[model samples]
Structures are given as structure tokens and as C-alpha cells.
Target: MATPLAALAADSAGDVAHLIETALTPVFMLSGVGTLLNLLNTRSARVADQIEKASDLLDTEQDKEAKRKLRHHLRRLTRRIMVLDISIMFGGLAGAMTCGAAFVLFLGSVRDASIALWLVALFGAALLSTVAALAAFLCDCFFSWDNLRKSGPLPKSVKKRSPESSASTTG
Candidate 1:
């Protein structure tokens, strides 16, 4: 009967709407998490630069107490940097999982405007999260490469320092 078929369609639409709602919450959460992680990464990079500068200043100091304080701060900063890196990686993983789940839901048999709207919104959030994750990952890699260059066996410096110079020694 037409009435029974219409009822079944309405039930199916309701189920799809529910699925979209369930998927959307996680998608938005993941997007927010990713953005926060990126912000943390940027802060960590700045802190690392400050730590390096502080280390450089300590090298020129003769005060034992000041040197010790500088070293302590530097160590703390290194630990924080490591923590930030780990957090970013975890956030990226969460974002990827959330997007994947949303994509699965999009493939379901849903026939409703509300369901479509939710699916589109979730997908957009997922895309933004993915972009943030990628940007953070690339920045991390760039910093890693810069670190390697500085610590490499032979840094390609334009001005070669003498073996006894402070520049080469501090480095």
C-alpha cells in the first residue's frame, strides 16, 4: 500500500538524519582539536627559538648560577616541544578518523535535505582539519630539517669559523 511505503520512507529519512547528527559532532570536535594543535605547534616553535637564544646568551656568561638556570629552562622547553609534537600527531590521527567516519555515513542510503546538509557540513569540517594537520606536519618537517642542517657534520656556512673561535665552539 502507498501509505505503508510512505511510512517506511519517513522512517528511513529519520534514521539518516540521526546518523548525520551523530557523525557531525565528532567532525566538529576533530576540526577544533586540529586547529588548537596547530596553534600549539606554532607556539612551541617560537619557544624553541627563544630557548636557543637563551642558550647562546648563557654561553657568554661566567656566572654559574645564571648558566644553570638557563640550562634548566632550555631542558624544560625541549620537553614541552616534544609534548607538542606528540599532541599534533595524535590530533591529526583523530581528524583523519573523524573524516573517514563521516565519509562512511555519506555513503548511506539517506533521502532528506537535512541529512545532505549535515553531510556537507561535516565534510567541510573534515577538509579544514585535514588542511591544518598537513600544514602542521610540513612545518614540523621543515624545522626538523633545519635542526639537522645546524647539527650536521659540516654545516654549509658562508663564513667558515676558525676551530678556536667562539662561534664554532658554541655551535
Candidate 2:
């Protein structure tokens, strides 16, 4: 009886270790999602800033062509912001589900409970949400790049020129 009990204890410890290993993948995924969220948020802030600048220009501009261009820019910026927001939301969801799955995995291991189906469902949801977030991010990037191509290259102020080059141009 003592031998059997000791063997069972060893098996349970091994099972817990396996569960921890399995949970590690989602932990890494959560970190990736966090990084992506930070990137998306930064991009969103940039788009918002562009929108503000365009709005100011639109208000003061008299030329019809210039106003039209500003309007187009504002439209594209608005769409990009929306897409980025959605992506952030989905990424957050993925992170939450991944955390839940990790918790459930540990809980099941400690309790010696069968939770394979629950684990699968949680991971599936997390993966699907992650995919949606990535898709939204891609769409946002496309919108930004397409607008840039339409508008031609960036302005001279955005381009970096060496001191010598600037002095020559001024002369």
C-alpha cells in the first residue's frame, strides 16, 4: 500500500510538470500579444495626431484641391484608427483567454480533474482571437501604406539631410 501511494505521488508530480510545460506556450503568446498591443497603440496615436493636423489645415485652406486632399487624408486616418482599435481589442481578448487557460490547466492538475476539452476550447478561443487581431493589424497597415502611396513621398521636413547638404542647398 505504501509503495503504491508513493508511486501515485510521483505520477502526480510528473503530471503537474507536464501541465506547466504545456502552459508555457500560451505564456509566450501572451507576451507577444502585449508587444503587439503596444505597437498598435503607438500607431493609433500617430494616426490621431495626423488627423488633428489635417483637420486644422482643412479648416484654413481655401484651395479646393488642397481641401480635397486633406479630406481624403482625414478619411484614411480615421479608418486606420478604427482598425487599430479593433486589433487592440482582439489582442486584449486573446491575452485574457490565454491567462484563463493557464489558470485552468494548473487548477486541473492540482485537482486531478479531467479538463482536456476545456483546455482545448480555451486555447482555441485564444488562437482565434489572436488571428483576428493580426488580420485587423494587417488591414490597418494596408490602409496606411495605400494612403502614403497615393500621397507620394513624404515631405522634405520629414527627410533627413546632412549639415553639409543643408548648407549647400541654402547657398
Candidate 3:
């Protein structure tokens, strides 16, 4: 007759396989959240760069009207960064909750305990957080679009990047 350990070993393979299947959904969601976070961070960085340029222009600008315009642009850019920050925060929260849900699921499987409630709660919260992040991103898009339309074609005090500029090198 097989020992208890041997029987457990025989049964564990199917249990582990089921756990992996159940865990895949959260992993996919986490990947999407990571992608969104990447987008938000990149947009925030670009906006920050614009803010720095605008600040420099505001300092050196002699015309009253130009200074006013620079200040306005700076305000809009700041608002964009704020919205992006919100998106980033929510995206990060979603990612964390997704990871937590995965952990709970794994723990439940290993311990032979029912973690369905906790998993559902965490996954649901993650979904909500993802929705919130997307909403913030959409708001930022609207703001950016309106700002662009009002500002017209020319970008004041912002230079185009060209090859050989060598302003900042990337590996």
C-alpha cells in the first residue's frame, strides 16, 4: 500500500496544474497594468521636460504678453502631470492588488483552504483601480487635446530634437 506522502505526491500534480490555470488571469491583468504604468510614466516625464523648458523661458522672457503665455502653458503642463500622476498611482495600486490576489490564490491552494472570497475581493478592487486609472488617462487626453488646439501649431520656446544634438545620451 502507498504511504500518505506517496498518495499526496500523486494528487499534487493535478492540483498544481489547476492552480496555474486559475492564476493566469491575474498575471495577464498585471501585465496590462504594467503597460499602462509605463505609458503614464513616459507621458509624465515628457510633461516635466516641457515644464522645465517653460520655466527657463519664463525667466528669460522680457515681454509681458509672452510671460503671461508661458505662465499659462506652465499651468496646463502642471495639470497634465498631476493627472498622469493619478493614473500612475491607480495603475500601481491595481498591480499590487493583482499580485495580492495571486498570492492569496496560491496560499489557498497550498493550505487547502478556501480563499475565493479574498481572491474575488482583491481582483475586483484591482479591476476598479484599473478603471480609475483609465479614466484619469482619458481626462488627461482631453486636457492635452484642448491645450493643443488653443495653443495653435507653433510650440513656444520648445525645440525639436534632432540627431547629433547630444543633449542627453541614452544607452
lDDT of 1 at 52: 72
lDDT of 1 by residue, 49-86 (tens): 86777667566656666666666656655765775576
Residue 158 alpha-carbon offset, candidate 2, angstroms: 17
Task: Report every candidate's CA lDDT.
Answer: 0.61, 0.81, 0.86
Candidate 1 residue 111 C-alpha distance from true site, Å: 14
lDDT (tens digit, per residue) of candidate 3 on 1-171: 665456457877887577568889899999999999999999999889989988998887777787888999988999999999999999999999999999998787667678989999999999999999999999999999999899952246544455666555643
| Backbone collisions counted per model | 0, 0, 0
RMSD of 3: 6.9
As for TM-score, the candidate ahead, 1 or 3, is 3
RMSD (Å) per prediction: 11.3, 5.8, 6.9
124: Cα error in model 1, Å = 21
Best-matching candidate per lDDT = 3
- For model 3, the stretches where C-alpha displacement exceeds 4 angstroms are 1-18, 153-171
Lowest-sum lDDT 10-residue window in model 3: 153-162
The candidate maximizing TM-score is 3
lDDT of 2 by residue, 60-96 (tens): 7767777777787787788889999999999999999
Candidate 2 local Cα displacement, residue 59, angstroms? 2.0
Rate residue 99 of model 2 by lDDT. Answer: 89
